[model samples]
Target: MPSSVTWGLLLLAGLCCLAPATLDEDAIQSASHKFMLNLADTAFSLYHQLVGPSNTTNIFFSPVSIATAFAMLSLGAEGTTRTELLEGLHLYWKEVPEAAIYTGLLNLLHTINEPDSEPWLITGNILFANLSVKFKDEFLKYVWELRHSDVFCLRFRDAKARSKVNDFIEMKIQEQDLDLFEEFDKDTTLVLVDYIVFEGLLEVKFEAETYVSEAFHVDKKTMKRIFMFRRSGQFELLHDEALSSWVLLQHYRGLGPTFLILPDAGKMQHLEAEVSQEHLTRIFHSMAARSASVYLPKVYISGTYDLKATLGGMGITKVFNDGAELSGISEGQPLKLSKALHEARLIIDEIVMDRSGARPSGKHRSNLLTVKFNRPFLVILMDKNFNIPLFLGKMVKPW
Candidate 1:
């Protein structure tokens, strides 16, 4: 079994928060799409900064989760701190009112996380504050009503407080064990955590017998043995001349399709350097459905990341320092973000044969072409309608 990779988004103190007020559904959707695009751009930019060109490690994180947490934290931000957060998130205060943005985010979250929604997705937010700190009634009310997050009070210095926080995270994610925090000191005042979990089954299940241990080329000189899933069908394929990459779209039962980008041999670095949300938007819009045989590895990635440096690099400073202003949250006791921690686990596996044991027929045998991801590739899980990235990652070395 390959070791699971952990992806984390940690924002230490003074971020943003979101909520829903009164707004038209259509207008809210439109506004939310715009917001998601900007957020996606910021997410990709942060990812690139965290995983520089020299690293070959597998990368994964939920942009929506991190953005949701920031949106919530933004509620308490004021002055230049607030401006930096809004600009950093690609939010133009002049164009869209802050209330509308919050409303849009809430509607978007509700739509994606609806109980009956396909491709099971779970998203949640929580805030743990020191017991001594008195959060303002307005801030608490908005966080609960708009963001749908729960607030808990904990003694930061308690030895058992760390275990309690960890327990809450585990329960929320349905995982048995998770160490969300190692230690809490006197300086630790507030902790904010967000998570997103997706379990998607391919619309067309892959046959179990076709699975095989294949050689996955980590690079030109290195290869690792990994299990790969094989299937042949009509798919939306694009040979992006601009990016010098082959883009493939694989549909899940519900929600948006997963995009897999395979750059030409030895061109991964160049593509990564040039890739952006605008470029991806063009490629996805240009894709046309065609018959092809697709081979992708069975991927399971679990990653943990500290996003302090990444957020700071993106010009979101001041929030971590003592001069930070979060008066909207508390009355008098000055509070700065003490810690931001995020942990996520994602498993991408093919759905086994049904009870009838049906197999793929020779439906598209006439124009069958082969497209295999035998090397490092990039994956983006997104909402088809809004083009919002639920999860973004790069698979370099599977292990």
Candidate 2:
């Protein structure tokens, strides 16, 4: 565990070395083959916690079935036959659609909290980076083949059609816009990149250029509510001083909240506005404290370039120093910083999967009958220690 900045720097260094080999078009296919193998290995370990060592025979069945069932089992699904049979089914399906292999696997495994028991030391040096680059290129080739060519796409697309009934059930979350979800439901089988979870909160960050800029243009207030599920379940009114605009909103769970490192007041001019380092330190301390409460609850985390415990149970763990000194805050400002931090925590608590909903957050829906596949026997997770993007990319259930 390191500071977010520390991990960012490490990942950057790793990327620089890996860039060259991946850039070459010829090397991609081989890279993907290797990447998938590694991904499967990691996924297996992750599901071990969710579906015990003795039970994990196949990567897609038993464990997946359990997780998809929302941690409970129906009468017929209780015995070893049901578990092992499901495991065998997943193993059969594992080799068919290759591009989806990595992402699907990761989501399945992560849902089970696979730990990195066998930590692979990723030396971000030239040689190691080049090796990763080679695999990354191959992985990209497999991904492209599935996405672009109609032949593979059509066959898998139908196979996926058979799979979506279960896929949709796993991805359905609370507070989701029913209208939008309904519209997409008919076609909600796995796509190249349908979002499942957004780290820990209701926020989503699409890949660069994934959608046209014009495709999304909500006001700041709405934008905040839309992505601040972990921060606040309720909506808010925000004033966009920069554009002299105002708007209304709604938020979701598991997405990170909006944190303003520096405030921007475009229109209303203030002569000398500043938050001294002392105040900043106090704010940081408050956050750190909330993060360290005795009752460690699940919270969503934002930002792209950091290594969270790739696999483990949910809770907060401090990294780096126990404490640091504060420098510039005036006496009154300390109390103000404390208040801000508390507000932020309260906002976050509101959106976590709690008893606030009539239906329990992580449990399956029973009132409305729906078809679900033999519990995904095992989850297939990706190993992105060498390539960070692959890890993050595969973390969600993408349909």
**Candidate 1 C-alpha lDDT tens digits along 17-40:** 211233244554466566656777
Instruction: For each candidate, give its TM-score against the true structure.
Output: 0.84, 0.19
TM-score of 2: 0.19
Predict model 1's lDDT versus the native.
Answer: 0.71
lDDT, candidate 2, 1-399, per-residue tens: 332222223332443444453332223334434443443323233333323332212212122222222111111122332233223223213443222222333343343233442222111100001111122232223222222111112222244433432343233322222221122222221121111222222343211111111111122222211121122222233323332322122122321122222122232112012222233223323342111001111232211111123111212111101211111111111110000000000112332333334431323323222211111111111222321112211101101
RMSD each, Å: 8.0, 26.0
